[model samples]
Target: MSTNFCETATRVLDIEAKAITGLKTYINQDFNDACQLFFNTRGRVIVSGMGKSGHIGNKIAATLASTGTPAFFVHPGEASHGDLGMITQSDVVLALSNSGETEEILKLLPVLKRLGIAIIAMTGNPDSTLAKLADIHLCARVEQEACPLGLAPTASTTAALALGDAIAVALLEARGFSADDFALSHPGGSLGRRLLLRISDVMHDGSQIPLVDEQATISAALLEISRKGLGMTGVLNAQGQLAGIFTDGDLRRILDQRIDIHQTLIVSVMTRNCVTIRAEMLAAEALKIMEQKKINALMVVNAEKVPVGALNMHDLLRAGVL
Candidate 1:
């Protein structure tokens, strides 16, 4: 039984892979015109379809919206019942139908035409009504379905989805859509936190910062490190500028030298010219520096190199940037 199941799964995967690969031939001038139309559209790309095609359309619309092309799905069945009002003259309609003759989607063509809305049809049948009437037609043809019976929409839907992703990514590049722009659309996600979170937002500030004067003993710095629990402390000069940093590694080095922590001034044992970051830097940038330098903590400094804040790998982990 397991052998049969594995063989069937492999067959399905092969069929779907071929389906997606075959979609490359369809990426021609029609696809380019569709992408250009969607990119130049001043309003949203209204995506519509029926059944499984509707499901794929929803995902395509979401991908387009997140990737910088404003888009939303309008179910064809729902559009016939009142949702058609959601589309406007400024919008472009992207209709998906494997057979290219889904009754519900085709029914809206006349109205869409009256509204002066251009239609980009994604279908397996290039000669079908949806394709013939559309302003741009993209062929998402598949030789066979992944299903053994060849009745399911598996291969066709996969081809359509891959084509949609290709168009969205093409538009994303044409528009110069960046990771920062993508982050703005997904502010609640980890990517957004990594891109949008600044060092000042996550770093320990003011009283929370682990700090000691250069004149203070290493013992005092250790106490501050313990109190702040960042595994390190910033040592400040007489002018309150960041002079150096003392971390657990420094303590280990001093211990090897048999130096007395109680008598040693922090500046004498601390790592001077320590790598520091600005408060305005992204927390993700701080993580990169820490990883590259093989350090766990950093001192956030002002323009004058005065210590304003402090952060460690733990803080970045807590902030979801790690």
Candidate 2:
């Protein structure tokens, strides 16, 4: 590592930290009005800027869209060519510029005004022309740039990014958004599978469920376990209700006692008060319960206490719920 590398890294950290801390002064009525404008807008939020500000605007637009607000990015350079048509009077535009004077963005202001679209300006200078002309102004001023040359966008851009996140989270809370709603927007990811996957979708049903009558011998239960390949079997009484469950652990206990597998009835030796879950429950919830109870297997029962399905640790593992 070079000596200058460590000093540059420290300067970057100090400047960014100060920028975030300085945001407290800017988080006032103007910020609230920006959120309100986005909340009430009938059309999508069209974010635009130039250079580094444009990059920040793109990220802000993405965060808003994923967090329940409808928004997308538009390049200011493109807006002059033909993309300005994308903005409508019903929509709200959020424009970013650290100097409040990016030429490319200034070129579109007259057209935006002509369309009667509301504009929110995010800039460091409140007195600049862009801020004066906007419906709302969000201050993203940083005390200094992190670059030793003090010319790069480093600290100011970081402040803008954090402000964008703050706005998204505030809207999310105001709308009472939940994890399931978030998963819906991110359906292609693992989070969606964890939140939406159900026990019935992962549990073994029908012939895969090991079952035996109360009168069945331990030898018969063992055969059912082997045939079903679940390392366990549900013991049912004459009424067809679940009586107990006999698992591989029980087999070990019986073997130590020298119980005759041929003569012992499963009902007499099977485990009572077994843990179970319903087929309709979330697979993630079942995983939590299994961990809390220190057990690896569970029976799926219906309202009638009839064994409808079964699952073990391996099932959850294969389902990616582990």
Clashes of each: 0, 0
Which pairs clash in the backbone of model 2? none
Q: Estimate every model's Cα lDDT from 0 to 1.
A: 0.92, 0.90
Encode model 1's per-residue lDDT on 267-304: one tens digit a residue.
88889999999999889999999999999999999999
Worst 10 residues of 2 by lDDT: 183-192
Residues 68-90, candidate 2: write the lDDT tens digits.
Answer: 99999999998899998888889
TM-score of each: 0.87, 0.82
Query: Judged by lDDT, which candidate is best?
Result: 1
State candidate 1's TM-score. 0.87
Q: Each prediction's Cα RMSD?
A: 2.6, 3.4
